[model samples]
Target chain A: MTRRSRIVGAGLLLLLVAVLSACGAQPVAQNWPGLTVGGGRVYVISGLPQQVYILDAETGVQQATFVPSGGEAGLPYWSPVTLGGDLAFVGFAESQSGTAGLYAFDPETGQERWNVPANDLILPAPTYADGTVYFGGSDGQVYAVDVESQRIKEGWPFQAEEAVWASPLVAGGQVYVASMDHNVYALDADTGQELWRTEVGGAMAAKPVMAATGEVLYVGAFDGRLYALRADSGEQVEGFDFKADNWIWSEVLLANDLIFVTSLDGRLYALNPSDGSVVSPYPYDSAEVADASDGLRASPVLAGETIIVTSGSGRVIAVKDAQRQWYWPSGLPQSSVYTTPVVSNGWVYVLLMDGQVQVLDSEDGGLQWSFSPPESQ
Target chain B: MGITDIWTVLILRPMLNALLGLYTVLGGQFWLAIIFFTVVVRLIMTPLMLPQQRSAKKMQELQPQLKELQKKYAKDREKLAQEQMKLYKEAGASPMGGCLPMLVQFPIWIGLYQSIIQALGHQPLQLLNLSQNIYPFMESISAQIPLNRFFLGMDLSLTPQQLGGLTYALPILVAFTSWLQTKMTTVGGSGGEGQAASMNQSMTLMMPLMMGFFSLSFSTGLSFYFIISNIIGIITQGFISGWEGLMFWKGMSLSSLLSGGGAKGAAAQKTSSTSSQAAAAGSGKGSQSGSKKRKKKRRRKR
Candidate 1:
């Protein structure tokens, strides 16, 4: 090409880049719902027009599919499937208008059992306990719905000052919920009355994890601080607020005496259970360790001696005893893993953003089998 | 790294960090951050823009000579193109000069767009993605995770379609400002009455409409960026080409449209008609002289 033509070609290429970028057909990374295992079936939600796929846990073959009733196109399933008894609960949003709600379905028959509607979008998966399903809504309310009747509990919708993006935790007959309004509340499970609300200094999205004995609760907030609160009194544990370099979006993992917490800054802190002190010499940094732009969102899953963690930039790293063991797909443009991998029966199942599920050997991080959703097929 | 990764690192990441820095400095007010960022970007681009403006002015001045060359070389397309290039070089102007700055700024525009999406992550997954792009040194930005997205009662992270009502005004403003900028840039230059002029006129209308439609579906933050950028571009162009290029008030008053050259009380339609007639008269004189010179050369060869 002549010099002028070459210059024009480069200019056109740059213009094309700008036009493509501005055209806004950007493929948004999908946030796959967390998987649920029950009755020999693995329940998963995937795709933009969200559908519930029930697959054989061992075979990874599709057994049943459930599409929400409204027949709305482009509705996304933000909340993962929550399995309790025979029913699976999922939340979906109408993409055009932002109207959203939760639906209960029978996994075996692929039938809609009940749906509890809400005015705003629902992101947190519903928690089931004591014949009551508890969840938070974007409308700044914690709702308790009856499992059998599939209706909102009477006088049961407790309002918060801002949106509640965290899943409600029910322990010791008290429902603990976190809100974007920077407050965490402990409500009476049966009466829906507020017991105590404590300000956590930032918007809370991660589900607060409670200890097995129900004495201490660890909540990560957008303020980059992890607060260990007394589960009963809703008071912060003395000197237990661990500050990270960035927001904490993943739930704190409690394994043995060590608490594993991942920050958006890509560092995983192993804290002491008694007090919020760093247990490791330094947090396990992902490959993008120095770069704060990428980090772990999928909470760490402990399988035997190994901890399986997925980073926001899409690398699945296996660490044992604070030592990095292995990471898969050692190349550029890795698929983002948004849903936490489900480790069950010695097999690690990872759902990628592109609707592909890779089941790896839990011990060695070797790929066993992979399955893509029907939409990809 | 792959192209997308390289783009994110070199363009999107820095722009996002700069925007977040502005957001922090502006006390977390996202709208103010957008406005200030737009101003900064435009100011940085000002030097590059001068070459484009100069080339445009030179191209306008060369129009009459270009017409003579076209008439002389009507039979030989190659000769006409060569003569055009010769004239352009003599005038110290390059056709690409008008587009080079825009090409340079294209990456910035795309980067700005990506920055907007990455910074104002409204959804959970988007927020997760945002976490990966933030700079580690920007502790202040990291602390403001879930940055305040609301500006003037409208969520900047949401599409205008998602927020019906007065939020529609953002898209309208985007279209209006875009159209105004296009008009200012295209109206005075390329002064002619032909298919090219009609095409330019249509483009001035169509580009803004297309952008407006895009804004309807895009996040409001992007729409805000488009509107602010266009306004800045108009002001920048005004400074270069004189304020007469601006067409406001539905083009009713002719005096306002004319530059301050003592045509103070002239009617708008009459002044525009007279200017076109004068341009045509000048082109006619050039064509006549060129044809006579060609005839004289033919006689001398015989």
Candidate 2:
């Protein structure tokens, strides 16, 4: 009788929740605020609307959205940057040449400061750490603009076999950049000299995350392999093939002793940080495909023990790190969420590529709030 | 460079011929052409698939004996393998029987999809041979279905074709069409349980839907292919499951005749089952007593 009551209660709760979700069912959302996570501020780059959305990081309430002041025409969605404090940087893309630059915005007020256009088109978000703002461009140069002067400082454009798409990573006075050349280059943070380079199969779209020890760098690749290289010398530390049946576009997330990653094959992988092994509890198999984006394209965010990952297929799954059990999915998206989810406190902030940034509670994966573009301008 | 090459001769030509036959018979209705094409494909595939189905039925009959043999040789894998071979021989069932139907069906599906794309000819050049003038209504229907709505609305060329294309409307279209296609083809068997299977089914439906939705920004031809192929597939599956061509006519007839009656019967059965468990069960008193004891224990525990 108790079992029956429990089942009934669960069924009722599920039915009620389903009904509510159905009422507020969003169209296939393309929320891809790519990998936005910082102190207390949650940021999402609304790629199509051509604006940056700032919301209460934990509560998912709309704080503000900043658009280019002088009637900005194009959307700057290719990349966005967080400066740890309240400052956020966004990059605009254009065909060949236009008003493509980087704007630093205040997360609280949605106000924009001076616009810093690179010598070339800003391809991705710049990295802001250690008194320097670092980003690369299609011009094949890694621009290190002084944070204070807001001008291009002594820059070192490492020439790759092809173009540069990934953002630079800073660790121990060095900036690590992965290139389409299938090489991970360790550069001098001060001078921008190529320190060392290691060839990885396929291009690396994901930025490398420095192991808490600042030795091994973990990043996923288009070759369907997760590579771990020595952050210092660019030597292969360890590696594992995702064999995703497709490419691995989702970046690797290191939380606790495990790494969370996804594939374009519609799978979320939890791997071992030490050896790049995905064991039983920490399955090599994907968690829940956020969407049918081919594989898991969204980056996974770690909120304490729970790892939240979204997919191009439009599913945001909460994976408990220790047990490796899926808590619940926020909901399937009508489309894919190309960007990663930002988890802070108890909330997971998702930047829907379809134009809405949704906030889901981390505990039960319940929808808390959603900030969509104001429809009529 | 043109997308079609000599490989077109092997797969596309045959399918196009089939499509041409259906289109000719149906008087150029896009929907009817799809139905005819699907029927022709399944009929052609049926001969190749017969051997496989028989083998599977044989396997099912052999499963019980195989399990018995497994139990008898629980301690010996070598002996178990030898005995299993004997059991298989006695049953006259090849172990690989199940994969045959799928093996025959998979290619037809792929070929059909490819043929649809080729027929729609999203590329202006490929459009050269497609017979768009076969029907007066065709030009408008062709415009309604997009070419790049690849699978669901997916631009086969783009990653998250909808998202990558930066076109949001496409995914929604994909989902709707995919749901329609799935409902048309889903197995009607009662045991539709298991969370994983449901998840898998949804994903399968979603992938095409995502592709279709993304196809909005792409060439309309791709979406047209998806719509036509799915409509065709559902028709084909229905024909295959429903005793060949007869089921479709019967289903159409029955839907008109039985929809209301069916609903009432289901509801009435539900109400009667609640009021009369004995009648619903229709078993002896011994089984009733056993069930009652269990129910009483459950009540007491509560």
Measured by lDDT, the strongest candidate is 1
**Leading candidate by TM-score:** 1
Error of 2 at A103 (Å): 1.7
- How large is the interface RMSD of candidate 2? 19.8
Q: Please report, in order, the local distance difference test score of every candidate based on alpha carbons.
A: 0.74, 0.55
Q: On residues B233-276, what C-alpha lDDT tens digit does candidate 2 reach at each position?
A: 45544454332222323233444224222122232233234324
The residue pairs in collision within model 1 are A293-B132, A293-B133, A294-B132, B254-B268
Over the stretch A1-377, how does candidate 1's per-residue lDDT look in tens digits? Answer: 12464456455655654685455745443355567767878877655535778888888888888778773665464688888877888877766555577788988867887788887777788999988899888778888988878788887899998778788998989999988778889999988999999987788888899988789999998878899899978889897758887788889889877899988777888988777888866488885422345677778898778788887667788887777877765565346776778788998888877667778888777887777886766
Off by over 4 Å in 1: A1-30, A96-99, A288-294, A313-315, A324-334, A366-369, B68-76, B193-195, B247-302
Per-candidate TM-scores read 0.86, 0.50
Span of ten consecutive residues with least summed lDDT in model 1 chain B: B259-268
DockQ for each candidate? 0.29, 0.02
